[model samples]
Target chain A: MNRPKKIKPWWGILPVAIFLAFWEAAARLNLMPGHLFLPPFSVVMQESYHLIASGVLIENFLSSLARVVIGFCSGAIAGLIIGGLMGWKEVLNKAFSPMISLLYPIPALGWLPLLMLWIGINEALPIAIIFICCFFPICYNTAAGIKSVDRNLIQAARTLGAADFRIMITIVLPLALPAVFTGLRLEAGMAWKVVIAAEMVAIPTGIGALLMRAESLIRVDIILVCLMVLSFMCFFFERFFLYLEDKLTGQWNQHAGY
Target chain B: MPAIELRNIRNYACHGVNLEVFSGELMVLLGPNGAGKTTLLNIIAGLAGYDGSVLFDGAPVDGVSPQKRRVGYLFQDLALFPHFAVASNIAYSLKANRWSGEKIEARVGELLDLMRINHLVSRYPHQLSGGERQRVALARALSLSPAILLLDEPLSSLDLHTSKYLRIELKQLQQRLDITTLHVTHDLGEAEEMADRIAIIHEGRIEQVGRPQEVFFYPANEKVAAFIGAPNILQCDKTRALGHGLVEVTCGGLPIVVPYDGDSIRKIALFPRDIYVSLHKPPGPKVNRFKGVISRIKDLSESIRLVVHAGNNQLLAEMPRHTFESMGLVAGQEIFLILKLAKIKVCEGGLCEQGDSK
Candidate 1:
């Protein structure tokens, strides 16, 4: 297991640096006709600094983060339980597979009107939407992971006098961890996207609300700041899940070429 | 150690199979591909369902769950846990059986030392070599101190040199442990080298069970004979009855004498090892003797294989490497050969005959 050489972190940000430089140059030279909507990179940076000084950016960012964390955790836990059961038991899989297939294709926002009538447009609304968005991919990926486990490992465990529950805990779950992590990482990105959309429609306290407020004021600089923060948050979540996955199932990933 | 007995075992992949493995003996189940060798082992370990009764030391274990059967099984793939290190893999059975932490650790240590893999305790399955992985799997299987051990083509995955080395090591370990064992393999040479008693299985049925020599030299029927590597199988061209319960069959212009039964023999299988070759004609009984020219020679490390063109038939003969070197044999040279008359197998009907002379 010879590991690949370490890559410098600054190399990854080079493209962003080049893009910002081009955008600033284009704006200063009046290269675009719709320059009002496309603010200069320096202007967006100035607006970000002003929002942070006034405490509005930190407050709104924390609100979105809290909703995502809570919604993602709850949805991920439920998905793990249901998906594990469905994968392990044929009867459960047969019973739930049709329903999952039908519901999985429905976008998270499609349930917004129905959910608003039931739970109302409150903080709970955005959290619920994020939950719906996170559940499907996590659930489906978890089940696929469990189903992909080698039957030989289970049989070997049985021959060693391991009971069904013991086998599930010691063999099945550990083997499926890599897949579970993949599901979690996918759902983490989706959680951020869904939460932002839900906040724009149903709440007024998150970064999505801040973006909507900026749009009404015709402040392109503020809108650009929100978009940059959201992009950074998504990247952060992806790296966080990747680090967790590597910590838990690094040996398996290396051995299996995952 | 307990003797394992399978009485009237019937499954999707097994017919009415009745086999008895003596206590503390390594019994090999020898057969060709898709011969239900693995199915039989699964039945014994209680991993597969069957209608017949499985008994350990005369006590029925037909209703026992696989977890409660107390059988050690080394699968053909080795099935070592990829995630767990060598020590953890061996300790898995102990942990599953609910041993205390101290006991588990001690047992794992003993197994690691016994398998001579103490240096690989922290290494994962993928980190170890093929032979090292095999040793770890063996140690894991033995951690529970099972009543009987079942090995399903355990050495089939390794290269020739490694497989040969591990075969002798496995046999020696099995002997030292004095545990009842059932080893399944498709290799006739492996069966002959390691088995105390060899059972020939074909098409989900036990064809014959006997000592290695008995099953290899005197296969009960055509299927067993063909599966046991009789390289000199010749189709008979004609047959004539000789007096005193003897019949002569002409095959490819060569006349072969076999003990007469009323049934007609269509083909005869002669083991390569049964054909004796010499440079000079010896003064002895002249039965089944012919002079042939060596058409080809194959060096097999331990033995030399010679293709002899006798009469109109090309016959294969094997001799010890030292004997072959001492005789200075070479291709295109004329030699005298003798086929042991009593060892020739007479096959009736067809190659795919379904008779079981158990």
Candidate 2:
């Protein structure tokens, strides 16, 4: 007889419920200052209900989302073109590889001092940080993906009489699109994390800025509400991105052969 | 006019590979592994660099690119693009050649019908069977209707039954289209079955080029003889020239006569089935009779292969299983074999000089 799994798939929800219960207990029992420092789960929930009712949540939500979307698009587009050129052309690779390697290792937040100096206390600063955060993964993955395209496909296309340029765009690019999308998803996650940090540090209107303001005001329930809302937003976006990817890949599978 | 005339084409894999393929005929480049058969095809297709000129329809094509040379090439590995549907795979070349969408659609449909996989139009290459893949590759090559078609072992990747079926179909298709084709294959059977002319390549060189029957019945050299699956290539010890185009030679210390030419009659190949085998030595005078023993017998699907051990030589012979069974031929049984003076081929240069064959 087969032994049943010690933790069933449904058991995955248990940890989150248990953690919220523990927090509620700790706050209600006065292990910490419930009103000023640490709020019970119920208190955070009540505060979140009010925040959503008043439309503050949606406003802060859109503010953060707009920054991430604009920054990510700019960064991903730039990365794709640069990475594609570097991967396909030797001269471009030699020219840009050295510079990219030098800059890629620095964390997205580490550029905060530089961005603040150059762009100086505006929405563009946080957007630039998100862009930098998203850029490297997309760029690196795209380049590697392009480089790893099956040489046989390229050769077959050429012999099939596809000109040099058409072969790259039609065959090589589509073949590497999956890897590029993988990079996009990875960078998206990074973009969310970095943009939040940027908003907390510099921006005044996003969810991260709300969390910073709550910290100074000692509104512990508001801080917990901000964390909960941001998690939900990021989770929703990830799921939405995945759904879009499945649709795109499903269409692609109709023609895929190799 | 010849479809392809390779004049003294020399490269590392090919050495002075001169060949003339007549229009509307299949010329097979037959060789063993690394014999440069594919390289020769590549050179003619303008996919490889070579020194000597390749003339297509009496006009030199060396300066042209592979695309401009207008030769359809079926790669040995098939090289089917994975991201295209079966119909689109065939249409790719037409699209590349700048045929209008309407023309491409018509050509693709025609090729799909000709290759007989119209049902598989929407199917991807990964979803195809081996035979389906072969047909798709051939269809993809023939879509644009180039002047010359080059096949590099088109059927090597299929099973025996599939290979046999496709071989006949490809030959028929080639005949119908009347497109000049150069086919490369390591299998002599494929060459024999499909080629109008066979060019036996060896060591990066053209050893012999002749009609299929000529190459089979009368291989130009010992290497050609061995390579053609003669199974009875013998080294001659002594040779005596007689006038009127005849020569007497000793094969494995047994006297044999051959209608020969040239100074040195060093070796010869005799087709095994052509030699008559019997248990009893005949009373009449035999011209080329040799005493040997059946060392081994293999029961094949339809034939029984017998390995006979004559003096200083081993000969392989095959006969119908029923006949072999009726004759009660057994291994280790002493036998007498007869070689007709007419059914022998004189290998101009002995295989001993070739040295590669063990």
Candidate 3:
């Protein structure tokens, strides 16, 4: 019975259209001052088609996406388990909170050189880096989400004959879902960023490597093409997460801020 | 229906509290704030650690966990699951107890109909009005058909009209269900309204447990007398026997005749609503009548409260707004006040022992 609201699609794309038109005009007029480095929008589009036809773009895009998915899923699952335990049991929280606090402040990329030495510059290296990036935010947010559950709700559950495990599953977890989704959305974006950086430094495949290759050859259009692909992928993941969050926890969104 | 008995129950907030709530009775635990009324309820529900035994229908449930004890608790905040719709909230216990899907659905539908919230089954807690939310909470508490119901100030947060309405509804529901209930509230009006038997608790101990009229008119001690809104407590200066089950006591330069008891009287307690005020003195026995001038007037919405200065005493008297208007009363006006002789509660040695006065 519910219908989606109508939206004017052009309103979303107007800014991109204006920027593209300006770039094409600048390049057509031969506007100097690093004009060679700044490729025209049309040139980037043409290069994109070439890369796609040759299967290079698809190959790198899939490889990067695979690493992000594997890393993000593994990190998110581990975060959920550890965070749930910590949040539920005070002893576990006390034992692990200090260590988590100590390590969380270090940037994900800060672990790269050591991870490259340990993981040896392969697919595992980028995946591990992305995993590190995804872990902390998800873990911290999950623990906080569980901790913030109303005590009265737990008491109400107890008086209703709900066992401890049932209370956790039915009351605590569902109440914490909105915060968990917040953590997931945050780490999803971080996973993409970390995977690209890791692929550039420690792996030979993916969009990041394609950018590195274009940089060495001074092929600015190829660099522009890689940037566009990364931008689209980031946008796609963000929208996907937002859609998932809304679908799963839309009823609680108004109260999630509490 | 199970009779709940707490024997010498000791906890962090409450100590050495002994009380019994009879089967199928709504016993209101009336107290001021920090009086451990909620702690006693928690002890009965097995949610709090206590030093003494809690018995249900004369069987000890000391070691029972809260979930297995079958106590339905309606928290002061109601604590309806914000994430669940009304149907889900009511079905929570049934689902927890592993009731079949069909049974859960049937019971939820039955409760929705009972609480008169069938149309709200699909709505979330935040989407409902205050009264609707309260009904949902009550329905959820009664979902498992719990043996004993513990309500902690359930109607304290409601508007006056809604609170009054729900008090009647709750009392009727409790009677129809025939469930033993321990209802805690700091509001005297609520306790008087909903209680079958009222237990006045102060400083973690039960001062008195009796019928509502007995506890109101004949408080067991000074603390219960003070907490139950006896606004005219005066220190007795002297007392003399009047020879026919009556004694004359001078309190703050005002001589009042009260029921005679053997123990020495030190103070006298009078409820504001029991005092009669009039513009002109009518034909009466004049046992405890005195001429007084109204010092201050307060409008209490339904009634008018006057501070009457009689001799060296300041007494609070309340009457219906219509009565006050008909008398054409104002501040500084002289009036004759009659303190009902039998209703004047006399305290002996700072404590009013039970059955000391009629």
Candidate 4:
């Protein structure tokens, strides 16, 4: 008797429920040892609560979060400046864009050994690695943003008597903000990923370190806890990014969304 | 004193073009597509690079940049900043000129009032309709108080109805502002409506410049005559002078007396409206009448345009719609043309022979 919408909200929740139920049934039925496989969603939820209550878990979580934020912020700032310069001047774009591409393809984790050799086992190693990982996306996006501004807007500014720097400040920056935000979204996620990798080897302090420790002790439950924490961080940041993106790009969508 | 003088100005697209625009005059630059009308405007505004000098109030302007030249330009597309509100767009010029905050606000407010868009000041450029956006663009240009305003086909993109309305507003605003202007358009109607003087540019060269009446009445050559709406250009061999601004020419093996005051090989131009049509050849010595068979009869409001094949020449005449109806005029119908000599302009050579070719 009810008119069903094309896409029902509750329909999306079905797949997650099925996945958890399958895992729980398999573990409880002893398809695999409960200790080795960690018995599914209920067990993981219980472990999450226990981990949160422990001060060590809270400390590691905060440390990882802090690393991501600091690295992403620094990297994004550098990206903005470099990208703006590259976009504005053809000479600069030629000079620096190739250098960026050269460094971009090398994996972020590839520098972990070099960073450790330089900064040693400290937070700097992880933060620096995260910063490096976030840099390329942010920088390239910013440059593209500036270049992509409608040429008519620039012409209008010139006719209004705007000088060079003023044009860049008032017209170019605002127009490029959407692209910068896009870069930020991508870079922020990269920074979080970098933090995990750095924490595992160089610093040994956060979720990645916890996963490594659990693996050495042959405790799959704790390892699953570390992964759950990482997944939660990615999910939380992605949501926050989407919120910001929606606020900025929703109106612009009508004009140039495609 | 001239408000703006372009001396031997040569640039890409447009060659050396010399022009002088007096203060407070609305000068319309008329041209066909790719005649370099826009290039001339851009060179004056410093938007494009060019050779030679553009003097604003007797000072050389080539050394000055676009912002420093103080010339306001409205591109064909009306390049209004899409990101800024209308008020902000107008105020941008003032801000760039380093006016104080209160001064900028007062100037912007006055322009918004002048442009009749005080209600839409907060709205962005994209939000404005075609006509509203045009007014905003004009207001933005005027805010700078430039030496001369360059309007590049300001109404070209609008619908026919919108263009007509904007043309009236633009003409009124130009007079009210008392700013020297260089307006460019390919439309003869627009030139007739807005120009104090018309300059017809063709192929990067100014083909002719004079008062609209002078250009329309006495076009220098065939090209200028055709461009200014001279519908009938009859190729005739002049046989003898009929005396007192009249000449007898053998057109299509038929000798037709035309009003020709000039000497040598003549290309006779006649306005379709000047040529009257009659059902029967009316008897009058005062009127020059010739019988012809109507080949094409186009019904236009107020008047009927008739293309008549008289002997070897195709003669076009216009009469009131009722006259054609009363006469029962149709295609293949025979009619007589009452030719008026005063309305006919005779040019000796072509468009290129005269006007600045070098």
CA lDDT, every model vs. true structure: 0.87, 0.83, 0.86, 0.81
Say which prediction, candidate 2 or candidate 3, comes out ahead on lDDT. 3
Each model's iRMS? 0.9, 2.1, 1.0, 2.1
TM-score of 4: 0.77
On DockQ, the leading prediction is 3
Candidate 3 pairs with clashing backbones: none
lDDT of 3 by residue, A62-112 (tens): 999999999999999999988888888889999999999999999999999
Q: Which regions in candidate 1 have their CA more than 4 angstroms from the true location?
A: A1-9, A255-258, B231-270, B273-313, B317-358
Expressed as tens digits, the lDDT of each residue in A33-140 for candidate 1 is 873677789988988999999999999999999999999999999899999998899899999989999999999999999999999988788888888888887888
- TM-scores, each model vs. reference: 0.82, 0.75, 0.82, 0.77
lDDT of 4 by residue, A128-202 (tens): 888888888888999999999887677767867899899999888888877887788767767777788777775
Ranking by DockQ: 3, 1, 4, 2
- What candidate 4 gets wrong by more than 4 Å, as runs, is A1-38, A245-258, B216-230, B233-358
For candidate 1, give the lDDT of residue B308.
95
Q: State the weakest 10-residue window (summed lDDT) of model 4 chain B.
A: B349-358
DockQ (Cα-based) for each candidate? 0.55, 0.28, 0.56, 0.34
Q: List the residue pairs that clash in candidate 1.
A: none
By TM-score, highest first, what's the ranking? 1, 3, 4, 2
Model 2, range A59-96, lDDT digits (tens) per residue?
Answer: 98788989989999999999999999988998998898
User: Model 4: which docking level applies?
Assistant: acceptable
TM-score of chain B of each: 0.70, 0.70, 0.71, 0.70
The DockQ assigned to candidate 1 is 0.55
